[model samples]
Target chain A: MNARAEFHDPATRAHLLADKARWVREQTLAIHRRAPETRVASSLSAVELLTVLYYSGIARITPDEPLHAERDRIIISKGHGSICMYPILADCGYFPMAALETVCKPGSFLGGIPDPIIPGYETINGSLGHGLGVGSGTALALRTKGKAQRTFVLLGDGELNEGAVWEALMFAAHHQLKNLIAMVDCNGRQMLGYTDSVVNLNPLDAKFAAFGWQTHTVEDGHDVAQLLAGFEALLASDSPKPKVLIANTLKGKGVASLENAPLAHVMGVGRAEIDAILGDGAAP
Target chain B: MKTTMRDTFLATVLEEMQASPDVVLLSADFGAPAIDAIRAEFSDRFVNVGIAEQNLINLATGFALEGFRVIGYAIAPFITMRCFEQIRVSLAILSQLRPMNVTLVGVGAGFSYDVSGPTHHCIEDLAVMSALPNLSVYSLSDHTQAPLFAKHCLAKPGIKYLRFDAKPHEPVCDAGNDGLIERGFRVLNAGRDLAIVSTGYMSHVAWSLLPELRAEGIDPLLIDLVAYNCVDTAALEAELAHVPRTLLLQEAVLDRSIENTLRRMAGGKLEAMGVGDRYIFEIGSRDQIHDAAGIGRAQVLDRILQHHAALA
Candidate 1:
């Protein structure tokens, strides 16, 4: 078996990356189609990062079995990117592919954002800057209980404005939670405008370093090879601090009309746009 | 009242942790006296999260998700009002599925912390805690009730808020004879002319006044409402119906304490006797403050007698 076949044959490895990416894109379109009035956009690189972590990295998930005690935790702090999460969850076989149809359905567990009730998702975090604090707590609990389970939290660059995030950062660093890893989806653009324009978290690496975190930045977030390599590096590192992977990504990637679109972060796409982007009857 | 509520709580917590090592304690720079033994015994299990109320609640939530039973300790205001949202999201919502039993030990209510000024006073805690769904609020009437309520809270699988005055309190009820104060208990003589429903230390004052009412040929039913949030509405209504009138005696504001109970049991002609609507402008001792707020034993009896006479 070649490199791709070896990874994709059992369908556990990055073979599902394409399918995960497709699921993310289609589900985002589905959310937009369902709630025409609500603004919905996809996080292209978030899907890619999730694909790398859930597929290739340390996350212990048997597609059929989602709740494994020893399994690594993936907390999505930047919950808006859940448009991508639901599909990736489906691709990982946490739930049926048809469950993706209920993305943001009224009173449905598969809300527009990540909620713990949806099986694979760890914590309910629509409010930004809360995930890190919760992740730190989980890490502390694991450490105290003598468990080796690692927790991975994905945060948006814009969410760093919250002081609670910094409070969590300081605590995590002080406690020396080696089992906790944070990945910032530095997609730059936020709801109003670019992140730099909003809060200017440009000196991101230096900030994490000051906070006593082992920080790394991946220039190409969509590059699966680079993403996987970063995870490997984190797992191997001996640093007595939390790891932060600042994955630089495009807000709306893959789809032509939405890529780097200013409004894509918050604006909704209609049925016509969904058809125009992924083609008709593309979602299975 | 063999064991104080604080002692019972610590004992139960230690027991639970021994069975399930995931049980952890987080405090907001308080509960030193209450949890000293627990801290000494289980050093790794206890955490002093500093004076940050919001951070403490968030940290507790995170710990809960990490498979740890997190118990947060602080004064009533800091635990209930300051970190209210965190409790709602982290404990209440999550406790619906998994056992997110976060034992909040709020030290003192009303005049108990009178010297600490209005900020420290937890007059609105019962009102606030009772309003939130999926939380078990227990206002320990005395030292004995505290431990019983605490152990009950720790053993059960849900979010529980426990309020206790730091100072020594008179033990009113015998938890040993009368089972653990799970629900409200009827004290004094049953089927009295007047019913005085009280919570926390204020119940001690109401208990003291029961004999005085009896001497005047007016037997008063003294009900010690242990759990404010999960008050047995049907049971309380039945007790209320037997009496000619009901008087809610609490250290907290009359509107929140008595009004809340009245709303819950919509049948009784209830008159509230506690701290009035206005903030206490004068500074004094806990007794003086209670006297000023008409929460003293004499004042409460007078209010009950006056209300009873007016109804007649």
Candidate 2:
């Protein structure tokens, strides 16, 4: 029996991804409620993006052997903003479902930021602007070692401000690293305020295209179906250039008070608020 | 003696790359005439990261994690300080959990790029690199030091920084000094009272004053401190304790002097000399800059003789 066969077909893949996206949304919010230190709003933005990659059967990974040599590399650069991974990794059997309860607590390897100690993470990612550079190296290594594995790095839109990211972009393209893929969670808001007001990276696609990446944008990154399609096309691209998916998402996707808030990145969700959100049809 | 460190080091790397498929040499577009051959023969493994030091280190760490022995090469100052955070987070921290053989080969030591000014001069690499928890610092003066460094890269599983001089000087070492290199320091010429200790080019400076001091019947120990952070502290301390005085030397800033380091170990008083806090804008030859900084051979010789007189 195909575990993902229900969603394996193009006809149902979108629907399955949508269904999983809701569960991921609720779980991400609930996890934040349990561990108030986790970045809830920032985490919400990448929920569907992560869902599409994992459930669409596009990423070659195993929960049992998360560090398998053949597994496609995934580096989540915005570590603080990637709390959605706690639920996604747990559901994928990367760790016991119960371990999610111990996040940010004593002896829990799952801290506020993801690290290699977590079975699925490729490297230490709490420090921003490292993922792409490191991922380019992994992609180069895969090619040099003659292994057919793609390396994917997840970055925040604001993370593009880092000069190192551009350095990586140039390197990946110059080397014709076709197997390296990046998904920028363009949630508009960084820690301080809107990325536009902070360090405007307008024409993000043109910026990436100029660096020789095969650039595309998902107009509504929150829409799971669109995300699934976007990833499928980029991964299937036979073009020699490295690829980038500029996911145009909101900083805070679901909660009424948090959505589009300038300081959503640091805004914490309380248990009472979490209860109210969950009770109100869990609309995300 | 007249062999440049960059030329000789790259030659050794090229030979090692030929012997193993897993060895990779990456440059930040910083090169030697000899590196062209390695790039030509091992184009697949040799990566020119295009003058970006931060990316160079991250790429090196990435390759090392994937099981390649990577050598990240660039000018000394940029390699040690420009991407310092990357070195601290990626290479140093990562090597603690994972076994990695990643050596950073940084050229243009101290006044080697004298005409190029302070930006090119690496005067603080030793102190800064030594501060990192898991990183090893290899400061070498001559071509004879290549095999020791080669062995570290080929089999060692950790982070290493190799600081090489830009200019080629006459090899001061008389060969067959494995014990000194391995133990990290050696008494080149054992003496009493004061000990003249130095590494890299400063070792030559320390050796120069030996005959002058010996002529005066002042037999201060002439010691060459080869490797940093790889030394057996207690052993080196025991050896240095024999002399009543120890003169620490380096081409880098005064803070990187071995005397400062030894003070932290056994708590001793010592005289220190090297490049001071001020940047060199004088635009002279290496010796002239050292002379301006009051650390040239003549000044150094005067200091040693003065010490001998004080002891007498």
Candidate 3:
């Protein structure tokens, strides 16, 4: 596989994006099929972001070999999104794709959240608001070593409430770390209710701006073109501060019945729901 | 006791950094005087994470994850209790295969910072550190012991909590000698009428009172317990067997350190000498708190004589 061939042309990029999105859905469905009891719905939107990065973005990863040093780092700060990340890692070839079947099993590495001991996971994170700090350190290490590798961290909108996250943001911005990019999965809804109802981070762009970060917001997170464009714009900028790509997305994006349904935050898809999402005649 | 222990600790850390380029020193914004020395000596290996205890631990963990041997330095409470979760998760669990060393200095073992109030007093640090599974806790008795134990901690793989008083302590053991490091030594031998088990800076006071006790025909044995967590239980039991009464002296609270030791040697009659259960209400020097806690040399000697006389 020529590394450049995955995203050489616009047409190819689009096809890869669609294929990765489908793969994300299929993998998510597989997680549900394997562990019928696990809560795997809160992070459906994470699948889109993981797919976009792994399949078409700059991370140099071979699914079979996730620990490759030169590969870009993807730290999922929103650890609840493990449901989305584990399958992508399996697809990337970190583990036997079938091992995902043991997710949340009695004694399996694949628990309800990410564990670094598992082949591709970088940091064992289930607690929110820790990824950026770890990522900052990794980015700093890379800079000190003069490595060209970049670090991409996925943070949940709910996690912004934590003061440690902002402390990390300020630290990254003060250091002017251009090699690091932080993406906030702005799904609006949290466990209790909408983000507005909880703490109302209405002007997130200005907040990032105030913190000395180069900030951008996407209206449609599911739009691969926009996601890629935002990433490209970030890569092109020579801004001394770190970048924050605010991806505004629906809670449950792909399946029509589950789209914008807050109940999907904790609800799992059964055989009937899975069939309905895949199509009426789809196999269980 | 002076500032030799601080100097020795800093010097040994610099030496370790020179040998292993991967060694990084993270301070919770303390020890600025040593900064120029470290920078002039080992430039790339030092980071002063300002006052953020949680960030300090996480950053160290991050460095450890990047294959660097990180040493997080701070006063006891800040390093151990403040960012405990980070220590437990990041350094303890993440670096379990080759665990990073986080050396907590300036632990107010029995009111080292008597005037800094309850917050600065690290009385329960031993209890807190001992509870952690993969961590080794050491309370250095004097300045000479600091460097020796530090070198061992740096070379060995795991989390180690090192508690030391900031000021210089009386030379309980010779700096050139490695006897204390290899085997836990009895600095003062008084034929076992009574034994005083001392840790950290208070061991000096315990040793100092031995001559007075011997003059009074109260033979008090002085045992310097260097490594608190890995204490030789058999040796302790043997020492307890000869003495009719044992006095556990510390600079911290009496309950956990002394009480736990006594509980372990159930047969021995133990009297704990240290700070009372309540926080020190009045502000004064370290000596004042030691006096208040009744762990000072005079207080310890009086208690020992009284206990021994009662048994006779």
* Backbone clashes, each candidate: 2, 1, 9
Model 2 lDDT at residue B245: 80
Which numbered prediction scores highest in TM-score against the true structure?
Answer: 2
Better of 2 and 3 by lDDT: 2
lDDT of 3 by residue, B3-30 (tens): 6566788888888887877778877777
lDDT of 2 by residue, B88-141 (tens): 878876676666889998898888899999899898999899878778888887
Show model 1 residue runs off by greater than 4 Å: A1-23, A34-39, A105-108, A255-263, A281-284, B1-8, B11-20, B173-177, B189-191, B211-217, B254-312
Model 3: CAPRI class? incorrect
Native-referenced DockQ of model 1: 0.17
Quick one: ranking by DockQ, best first?
2, 1, 3
lDDT of 1 by residue, B198-297 (tens): 8887887887786777788877787887777677777778778878778888888765455767866865477776565333323344666688767987
Write one digit per residue (lDDT tens) for candidate 2, span A129-207: 8889989998898899998988989999888899999999999999999999999999999889999999999999998
- Which candidate has the top score in DockQ? 2
State the C-alpha lDDT per candidate: 0.73, 0.83, 0.73
Ranking by TM-score: 2, 3, 1
